[model samples]
Target: MPAHFRQERTKIVVTADNEVNIQTLTNWKVSVPFLVMLSDSSNITMPITIEDTLNQCFTQETTEQIIHLSPVCANLLRRVTASDPPFKLISVTPSPVGESGEARCIIQGKGIVSLEAVNQLGEHFLLATTYLSVGEYGIHFSTENLANGVYGIILRAADGREQRSVIVIER
Candidate 1:
């Protein structure tokens, strides 16, 4: 006998002794929406099971399919759609320096780049901004007017990506 029941949040459960294997299909036609709905409405504990089932079915799925299931799977598949870091910090030179000194670094990537200097007290000071082509570029900045302390040199891309490094200045 097949069992049918409804739960508090309009969740319907149907159980039967059928020999249908859901994992054999190349694409999920009816199951994706149901899994998505379960993920969005169910508690974290219950959603784990649903997420596991979705993962099993989508083992061979494409990135687009994974992205489409991310929202419903509570961002379980977010890595598939996440953006890569816009830049790589090759190196930062002269970590400890005098108040009036020059600092330089090589950054490699492609994007509109901007930088900020943040103090311990959470104060942000703009350093530089420019568009970089798809290659390695050099960055130079002066600490002539900066006070003696530690500061974070933050590099940001127009696409909202960021990288940070620290520097200490002493008199």
Candidate 2:
């Protein structure tokens, strides 16, 4: 079981996936540790379980990887939309991008304020959030697969008026 549904964490999870079908192989391994406290989590603060087997690996032959456990609700739908607008971020861009290149952002004050890109800045390590309506305005990111350094550019505006910046992903 290797499920992953990330909202804030470096290391992609593909949102959540679990697949196991081995009649008999040999090498098999799976791990989940980067702040994993999943003691079969029956507490639920960020508790995750998709057949609860959070960590184990003693391989011989069968191999398939990626397990972090998420997607019971997937962080209640990681918010790229779900409506939280009051927009007004204005900008979050460039700053020496490279690892994949192409990064841009903007928000005007009114509504529809959502933009996400993170690899570390305050540690919510998420990367990329989409809201496409292209033609003008601004909002574009490609970053290939992202992996360079300093990547945090956030703006999820509403009443709190959130805004953060730091993109320096040089290759």
lDDT of 2 by residue, 1-171 (tens): 344333234332423334223223211222333232222211222323444343332121224344333333222322121122223445555557664333333333334445556676445534545443321255555665656666666656333344555555546
- Per-residue CA lDDT of candidate 1, range 1-171, in tens? 211112222222322222212222212222333343221111111111332343533232243222122334232221112122234555455667454323243334557777677888988877677887554556666666667777877767643444455566665
lDDT (CA) for every model shown?
A: 0.44, 0.41
Per-model TM values vs. the true structure: 0.42, 0.20
Candidate 1: which pairs clash? none
Clashes of each: 0, 11
True-structure RMSD for candidate 2: 15.7
Model 2: ten consecutive residues of lowest lDDT = 77-86
- Tell me the deviation in Å of residue 159 in model 2: 8.4
- Residue 13 shift from truth in candidate 1, angstroms: 44
